[model samples]
Target: MDRQKRQLQILDHVDLTLKEAEFVSVVGPSGCGKSTLLNFIAGLTPVQSGAVEVFGAPPGGTEAPLGYVFQQHALLPWRNVLQNTVISLEVKGIAKAEREQRAREMLTVMGLDGFEDHFPREISGGMRQRVSLARTLVDDPRLILMDEPFGALDAQTKLLIQEMFLKYWEENRKSVLFITHDLAEAVALADRVLVMSSRPGRILAEYEVGIPRPRTLDQVRHMPRFTELHDAIWEDLRGEALKAMQGRA
Candidate 1:
């Protein structure tokens, strides 16, 4: 969507892009329509105004390459982890051999090396999320839309998953639009960060994370630049969050 006159019931004057292989993050207070914005881009919610295009094509159009990882691990209960990861390929009518191979590789990369036969219930929350990421990445979509995929995990688990995700991104560099409430996460994983305002959400601010390349999640946090960016982003985000909580914006 262009920056000009963009609007939706929950979003307004919004414009953004995930350049080829670039990583981006959006942060804002609750109800700022962050998730709503993602829904529009993923084509789960139609744009009531302006437009949302993926890879220069309308969301879900034939030319768009997209994948989404929702906050909840929406895994199939009856299916084993391996089966769940291969479902998308299976739907595309890929040969069983090829699909399973792709899924296994992705699962291994996501750090789900051996629990392939386990059901979702048999694994920990973080592993379940690893399976979710595995499922999404197996499709090899050019653009990934993540909606707080790590929000439910404990601190350690979240950090572990974030590290895994960053490693994957560093190597593959697929375009990503990650949504989160964690300022540290936003700054750590994205090349660019966006802050949205309260209901009737709009872009409030943008930050470019310039801590340098070959950055590690652990190392970045201790860097002076990381703290600086985090503080700066929070200064902008905090106000909107308060405004949202107070219902004054």
Candidate 2:
């Protein structure tokens, strides 16, 4: 509960866990504290009650690497691609040569190879997002939190980035907590999907993707199991979505 507004509870008794190399996606109606949950895991918000542990340790203050890719590109306009990618490392006091080398390698893997010197304004939105991903991943964070990182992109760019992200996850196998509202995108990208309640957010249900990985979004959406899972989750989500909308109205 907010001390300022005692009745304004954001989340209540929400429980979640992401295993090693596991990819989990969370979906719910708007204003369900989905981002609040991410903030808790990222250590940006204080845990008012209950507990949050990463690898059996409290998050935020450890040397353990943690990465976050937000909805916005959040790239520095003045900094070139390579420079932006290594900013985290620079803050960590890594040697300049080592940080640049790692950042360059990640940028290359992200398909930004020849655009190292390009500023944020010079690149497309999609390319800027790739740089953001490269920056977050360059430090090799064991846990990654992505809050609708592709939510702002066009359909084509979203699909392309999904594929790119899948490739990166397949190669590195990092534990990820992804927040997205698109049911199809959630099922396509995650090993498991979590649904939350309308307000005072809580986990409503969990669905295993069951679909094979190395999955292309187009291919997975066409599968029978994908449809089944999507429909089933929608049954639970639809009501909450309606309730949220009505509350807004």
List the candidate 2 regions with Cα displacement exceeding 4 Å: 1-7
* lDDT (tens digit, per residue) of candidate 2 on 11-89: 9989887898999999999999999998988889888888998777786867668999999999989999999999999
Give residue 112's error in model 2 in angstroms: 0.9
Q: What lDDT, from 0 to 1, does candidate 2 have?
A: 0.92
Lowest summed lDDT window (length 10), candidate 1: 1-10
Candidate lDDT scores, in order, read: 0.90, 0.92
Candidate 1 residue-wise lDDT, 1-249, digit = tens: 766965446888898866899899999999889999888988888777798877777876756768999999999999999999999899889999999999999988988888999999999999999999999999999989999999999999999999999888889889999999999999999999998988889998998888787778889999998999889888998878888889953
Which stretches of candidate 1 lie above 4 Å from their native place?
A: 1-8
Clashing pairs for predicted structure model 2, backbone only: none
RMSD of 2: 2.0
lDDT of 1: 0.90
